[model samples]
Target: MDLMIANQKSLRNLTVLIIGAGPAGLSAAIQLERYGIDYIIIEKNKAGGLLLNAEKVVNYPGFPHGVKGTELAKLFTSQVQIRKIIKDEVIKTGYREKYFETRTKLSNYKSEYLIIASGTNPRNTNVIINKSAEKKVYYDVINLSHHKGKTFAISGSGDAAFDYALTLSKYNKVIIYNRADKIKCLKKLYDRALQDNNIKYVKNISVLKAFASGNGLALTLSNNNRIVVSYFVIAAGREPALDFINSDKELENLIKSNRLCIIGDVVNGIYRQVSIAAGQGIKAAMEIYYQLNKENN
Candidate 1:
């Protein structure tokens, strides 16, 4: 789009610059629009982030039949367009005095306040494997329909692991392998998964390596055992994507000062759900407005 950089003095009229146009970022954008505040949203990838990879989202509001992850993302983008907000991605951000300078690959912009909703990045195991086998390992299992009737293996001990296993079991023979002896997911979910005939639970099993074998994959277990599967899903967890901005003391302190404000996945009461991210977005926007108004008065 447009990549023009306005004079620094012109930014005095702007209130906030939101980074990452995911659910949370867009939610904040909507709230800012309602408050009549001048703000812009910047995203590195497309607007939806990880949610775009989801196969189907049933927990989100309003849609009873459930909506595809990509479609839901489109709805969010449509909302942003209807509100007519500025959107771009921040390639580099720096703090100067009380203002923040944000530069994308093509343009530079400045803002009085910055909301970092960069979200989290999926965590992956460091096990070395063939390139083709590595390609089959997925961080998120939102869309398992593509692998119907396939033999799938998941490595994780949390709710997400169980959730993925349960969801994929409906169409595939699913197996969950964890490094620990006990399952750490919610008791209810763990109990439910125990009842599934299609799901095989294997604990204290670590994947030492994996390789492509014909149409599927062959994984070598740490215990010298081997298992062959059509796909591998790594539900290990995720870490906040704050590596880019964490080096700045001022920005880091701003995040710490605002008790409710968070930089990534560790934010209180926040989950790995699209709805929760959207809620955080709205909360951050309102908090920014409150702080700005308080300072003005």
Candidate 2:
């Protein structure tokens, strides 16, 4: 068979292909499993996506007492274990007559329908901190519990920053820094941080410079005040995590064909919640199921 034919044949018999293993993608997989549909999920990194970085997930449904992001991710992952998951990255995507083809680092996959739940990546602050403190600076609050009881200066006043504070406050002192006077996080998170003696919120302050010392890191604020901390976590924001295609026309064609669906944080918006992403995934799967049924009839 030809190249195009070969690619399609390789992924033949699969009803749909889902990209990314985040809450959105896994949610899609769960729905497909319930329908007994043949589908596969491809992920470039770990299965949990950005949720793995979350220190705590307070708003996600079913957990009135709240749950850690890692725990919540594990729960979502467990439900989709029956579905096929390929640990690979999709480098490109294209559309052919009735199917869409995706090229990954390892192989090519094709399906009648596509669900893009790639999610987003943490936005870099572009602040140049001392290279020696590289190990002490983190973008997310993962695997840093061993440094408990130490002080942490978290940049950014978003939900992630507050959440990190709440998690770290269990054993560590946290200082949340915001460049502007207005806070971006939810009122609940802000109030919670206030109630916690371990968490301190500092606004209208900018980190001018960061220096690494033998003990930890020293940050110079815009006001020329220096504060030393054991670690620095930057939770500024996130940008879409999308792979590139050959050209805009190809992407436009795929989107125009109505077989390609973009969901989750990859769609790009202010709201980034596990529950929202999961709901979107279910909606996309249901739409695809109806479309397939109509076509089959």
lDDT of each: 0.74, 0.82
Top lDDT hit:
2
lDDT of 2 by residue, 1-297 (tens): 012545445654467899889999999999988888889999977788878877778788789988888899899999996448889888777677677777778877768888989987778776678778787888777666556679999999888889888888889999999999999888988998999999999999977667798788988898879888998888888888774544466566566655777888888588778889999889888878887788899
Clashes of each: 2, 0
- Deviation from native of the Cα of residue 225 in model 1, angstroms: 1.9
Please estimate how well model 2 matches the true structure, expressed as its whole-model Cα lDDT.
0.82
> lDDT score, residue 252, model 1?
59
Q: Candidate 2 versus the native: TM-score?
A: 0.84
Error of 2 at 274 (Å): 2.3
Show where candidate 1 strays beyond 4 Å.
1-14, 45-79, 82-90, 105-107, 142-145, 252-266, 269-279, 294-297
Candidate 2: deviation at residue 5, Å? 11
